[model samples]
Target chain A: MKVKSIQCKKCAAPLSLHGGGHRIRSLTCEYCGAIMKVQEDFALLGQFKDQSHPDCPLSLGTQGTIKDVLFTVIGTVSYRSNYGDSWTDLHLYSETHGYAWLSYQLGHFTFTRRVRYLPSRNMKQLSPREILRVNDQPYQFLEAYQTEVIHVAGELTWIAKVGDTSILRDAISPPFMFSQEETENEQEYHLTEYIDPEAIDANFELEYDTHRSFVHPAQPFKAPIRKALSKASLIPMALSVLFMFFLTLLNMGNTVLSERITHSQMTGGLFVQDFTINNANHLVEIQFDNAYGSRFQVKDITLFDDTHEVFTFGKKLKVKSSTISSQQGTAQFKIKKAGKYTLRLRAITTRKWANSDRITPYISLTIKEGVMNNRYLKYLFYISIISFLLFYISRYFFNKKRWE
Target chain B: MPNASHYINCPQCGNQLPLTFQYAKLTVCTHCDSTLFIEDDGVRLAGKQSVLSTIPSLLELGSPFSYHKTSFVPVGKVRYAHTIGYWEEWWVIGNSGKGFWISVDEGDFAVEKPLDLDSRDVASIPSRDDLYLGQTITLWKDQWQVTEIDKGKCEGFQGELPKILKVDDVVPFVHLSGQTGQLITLEYLDTGIEAFQGEWIDPFEIKREG
Candidate 1:
């Protein structure tokens, strides 16, 4: 389709109509800001002067291919929100795909196309945070604002003036945003998708700032490694916990010996108990309990195989507190020999207000075998949980910033 | 099945024109750009239509293209000039021996098939003045929103067409869109109201068949 070159009706400035076909209704002169109605023999519509041009990099007739469709920039409209935020929308026309828009704001670019699908609810009735399904995809309303056409250049599909305002509401479903624009006469819906600045640059073969200052609502989070880690850690984390639970149920060993020693049975402050060991493949536990408030101390606990000391644990255990009715402690060790094992305990007094020989405490001792140590499994579970949290926390913050 | 061919002489230029489709009502003489209207009695020269200028396009007359895995050969085309620009409707024949219209307005493309108003329980269609943009109406057992209401003239034509069209004939058409991409077009012609039902086609999906 060829566009005829014409002079501006108001300023007589030479202008070449590169595109927009017959759909564009108004052509604005970039020199004197004169808007002409293209259908009415280029009649002067209005003059909008003293307006600043937006920093748009794409000029009229700049051709680019987006999603395999070739489009040319034919018009530009600069719009300002009610809150003073400004952006530029470049009108794109393709000979085969009709009109579209490339919006640029804060170093971000998004492609927009008019959609016939009306929102489930009216634009004015929708509030922020409300979810509306369009084409079965959920879109959450982001904001509603008034957009004023501040400046215009090239050609537009409608007769846009400097102060033409429309109430625009936007809803986002990541990678895609649905916008509803309502004027006094008509309501229109447009679908926009966030385009990476690098993609825009590559498509047009031009350098752009590409330094986005804020996260766009339609921009998808791109942390592939973190997302993969978060998802991949879940199975192993669950498996580690399940293994620990099953290990605890299956490793409860039985007790082999239980004995009691009286205080008067000590001759040289030594009490001996002979216990036979059955299985030496697992761990062994020796537990002792003494009468509470009895001022006594155990000097040494030794396991001897026919008077040959196999293991000696010499730790002083004192029971002095009167509040505790009984004092208990346990010691664990690995034993190899399965023959007769004799355990000996040496006792002494720790109190000065009583007779040293008569204040010996009565003690009860028990020996258990085949116990399983699960310290390594417990550490593995903790590590798995921390690794998952690290990835999850990063992704959570990334999403939070995107929504903000 | 046996294939049949039809030929006619241009009343204006005495040039022989081939009418490939049996239902072809109009054809343009390639030698003199004369529009030949085929009637039940005989062919007559309707008028001289302007020759279409060369432009980059996906479909060409006598060329086959595949859309949605179905091959269609364009036999004729009619260009309608609107207020801002022009749109072309191509008369295409599918591999199944059915004929359809492929409308290309700027970049918008639609494959439209003629709809019988009586079969769809539609007794009448609203006049061009009675319809407005964004207005919804029930037709063909579905609700359609009026997206555009425009009047154009038959500016130029080429090859063969399925309907009798004269040069500079006023064509008033209304476009309605469904919730999905379905489209219903109503053309108020001199004879009667002609309706077409179709869906929007993505231009990228059309592949030129060799």
Candidate 2:
């Protein structure tokens, strides 16, 4: 079968067949360590179809016929040295240049391997001492795909297109460098994120099976913890029902009280004052007369919880042209505890104050007791019963399941 | 039964993975991130996978089985067959039957639909040097030879293969010769749409006297 040989496709190393049937479809090339296949029709297929991820500095590999053989090599390293520690280079060349310098070393290891082109005239040839040092270090570049060493020992020979080093350079362009610091900086923004279920499961299974694995304590679903979880799930539902009942009663009472206030009219003053607390225990109403002449505007009204300013009504309030009438302002503050409070009232208008020493109506308040609607009591009763029912129902279910 | 099979090597790391069955469209070496395009043109470097299969029923095989000569001219144009769904296949007659489901063709390149991964779709279709959507590509050996580029077709719709084609529409034919390494020959269909032309050298230039 006259098929397109893999050796003819590459530009570097010769395909030295390593004891394989020539008729076989695919064979590994000994020179470049690349697996060559013979396809009847020449087609540029996918690269890395059967190969591992390329290591930073790749190893050597080849394709195409022996006369047109090409080998490729690639690797990566990090350095703390002045020249930035690591060097990565990939070169491709024909096999005619048999002897190749793998790499060089001053202290540790520095050099090149699987080389097809010689040093340019600008490059200095290694001295005997330098050669000895490189030989002593004895580092050979690996083949590009896998972790295989590259070592060459032979007489030198010249091949066609020795200057085609640029082809290899074009084949394996330098990859973008991401330093360690930059990589970590990038990860900081992405670290506090969720991993997919498969990834989490894999990590848990691989690294910490002891702690992460679900322990089957004889019976899987019949454990006491299962009963606890089942019981706990009912608590929120019962509490929600009781909460809704109290909210309804409070809404009903507020509606009834607002209706009674609507029927009262302004009498004996510019604003009439009326106090109605359904089921009132003790409530008081205070009346204030606007003393400032020529209709003073209401400035700011602030409700304070002692030193804490709770609410402030600072929007505009208009007053009519009357000063002798009783100015009515009602504060329906719910007092959780009976206490005395100073209600400061300040009224100012741009019409101008005639007397600077004139005193405005400010009152001191003391609430002995306030009305309590059945809504709150009803809410408490409902919550207590629901909570008790939930607890006992859960306990009963737990006992029934666990005692089984 | 199996979709396509490609024997490829890692261009960067020299790793090799024979992509077979549904996995032929796209795959990455867990070791390296080098990409791979399933085609029949350019160089099949180490770690590259080429499918080895005969043309399937859907893939049309045109004239001239075999002839050895130095000068081979691409007879006609290699037109792109744009179908809607993913059921379309590109099978070649190599030593074995090989082909791929070209699931996507952006402006510049053609990509194969991948295997059943976590996401039931292709991770990504790789870009080949010569083959692009709407362009006529040739088959070199077992790869694709991008010959002439035709920007004639409007941007294609995105969808699966079977959904795209009418049941009556014919599958395009891929042609090759020992004379020229690649040739994509498309049939003149009455489907009314214009066909993309591949590399065509005038036949009168060479003497067939031998």
Candidate 3:
């Protein structure tokens, strides 16, 4: 509420020093185009006439709280790059905290503060992709550009001229940027962080263009849920792998019956055997081994518990080659009762015209119980891998957009 | 140590002024704003110090404030005018009965304590002519980078101070920054060079006491 009142040295217009404390050096009259040196009895330094004012939502002496510190907008400097890019920087001041900058460019806002920490190398000497460390954190060099001051108003920490030019270099470690400003007399470093438009609107209560057409280099990626899910997916992925390992270890079951049936043991093209299943509520596997050249077909294999039939399985087997080889086939079923079971198999041999002699073949059969099934865990492991990849892929593209 | 109840009459205004600290060297008369210099022989009138403009500040003269759970009362202040503007340093008495300095420049704040350097250490400090900005200097086994080298003059004073200061007397100083917001300042005084070491303090962390 307390401010210094002075009259313009040229136009005699009333002026008020709202902030910048005792450190400000110059104040420019908005009514007339005269710049006065505040330290030297309001002496006229120079004049900038017919300069157009840039679009700014906040006016001089507008108070706003940023990051828990109340600051007043004391000055506005509009700059234009050689590439035709223009932005406005608002000089902010606090009684207890010092001076800072709120820059608005392309519908984006960023808050910047001068930092004492020095970069590892000079800003002009840095190459693209080269990292510069400030306060022990790495920032990648983004760009370097030349900007000239086009318009200025109100009070500033230093003297302002309309045509003053400076070179600025920027480096980013996203959501944060390190900028180096170099002029003819001085070089300084500033650390800037991106601020959301909603936050700025809430604090300053200004309505301007809030639509951003491109992602800012300092804007943070907004997919927090995806990032969290990416981190959380590792837990399920690890558990599934561990369970698959344990299932593999318990894959082989106890062999309950192993027998060989000769051609002479068969009666009327049928073979019968009695097997005792010791473990119930387990997967029972029935496997058969035969010679490679045999053309015998397994018409039916039946399992009976006492008088009722439990299950039946059948397969036709044809030998494609006879080059001193053998083959095996297996069938699995879950057994619920631990009791004596009878197995019956019916087979028929195909007759060939070239061989008149009866070449009867023998078969080997094995039965086992308590084998583990790991089909569902395999599917879960695949789904977890897919989820992990999806989250990271989205993050990668988001970062790529930011850098681009 | 001087008596806590020690009082002196201003030579210029004839007002009673209290010497609250043991090493008090100068006290400004609240009645007429005359600066009084305390010497071994007697108190002498230095000059009149200009009253600074009222600005909302975190620490005020004679006001107790708590920082990092420790309480301190600012007894005096000296404002120095530089090329850019001005900065003020407050002389405060801590809860432990020790005196320290808190400097406020623009928005930056620092709490400093006087540090004694040996003859060898004093000799190693670069002269004012040889120092440059961004140059590194090793002190107290730590590397410090020179941030600013400026020459300022005493603009005014208020309350009491432990150092003899005159209005418009030129004082050159260099500011250096170390790891973790640490600061080291070297002032080129007429007697010699004086050094103080401390760390930067956040203004928000200071809690004012009524």
Candidate ranking under DockQ, highest first, comes to 1, 3, 2
Tell me the spans in candidate 3 whose CA falls farther than 4 Å from its real position. A1-17, A25-59, A80-86, A161-163, A196-198, A206-213, A220-223, A255-368, A375-394, B1-22, B27-54, B60-75, B80-85, B92-102, B108-160, B165-210
For model 1, report the TM-score of its A chain.
Answer: 0.73
List ranges where model 1 is wrong by over 4 Å.
A1-16, A40-44, A55-61, A238-246, A249-380, A386-395, B1-51, B57-76, B92-99, B118-123, B126-149, B155-161, B164-170, B176-183, B198-210
RMSD of 1: 6.2
Clashing residue pairs in candidate 1 are A22-B84, A96-B107, A97-B107
Model 1 chain A: ten consecutive residues of lowest lDDT: A315-324
User: In model 1, what is the error at residue A267, expressed in angstroms?
Assistant: 9.6
The order of the candidates by TM-score, greatest first, is: 1, 3, 2
Model 2 misses residue A357 by how many Å?
6.2
Please report how far candidate 1 places residue A400 from its true position, in Å: 3.6
Residue A58, candidate 3: alpha-carbon lDDT: 77
Per-residue C-alpha lDDT of model 3 across residues A1-404, encoded as one tens digit per residue: 46778898888999888867776888998777699998888789999999888876777888888887898988888999987888889999988788898988877889998875678878888887799898789999988999999888788989989999999999999789999899997777788999988788889978777888778888877777777777788888899999999978897899988877665677876888888998887788888877622455456678889998887774334445444255567888887789899998776554332345465566788888897777788888888888778777887887888766
Q: Which candidate leads the pack in lDDT?
A: 3
**What lDDT does the true structure give each of the candidates?**
0.81, 0.28, 0.83
Q: DockQ of each candidate's interface versus the true one? A: 0.45, 0.03, 0.44
| Cα RMSD for candidates in order | 6.2, 25.4, 7.3
How close is every model to the real structure, measured as TM-score?
A: 0.74, 0.19, 0.67
Deviation in Å, model 2, residue A278 alpha carbon: 2.5
Q: Residues A1-404, candidate 1: write the lDDT tens digits.
A: 47669988888988878767777899999888999998888889889899898887788778888877788888889999998989999999887778899998888889998876667766577777798988689888889999999989988888888999999999998899999888998777888989888988999998878888888878877777766776777877888788888878866777888877765676677888788888788878888877633455666778899868877666445434435455567777888767789888887644433465554446787888887777677887787787778776876887688766
RMSD of 3: 7.3
Q: In DockQ, how does model 3 score against the reference complex?
A: 0.44
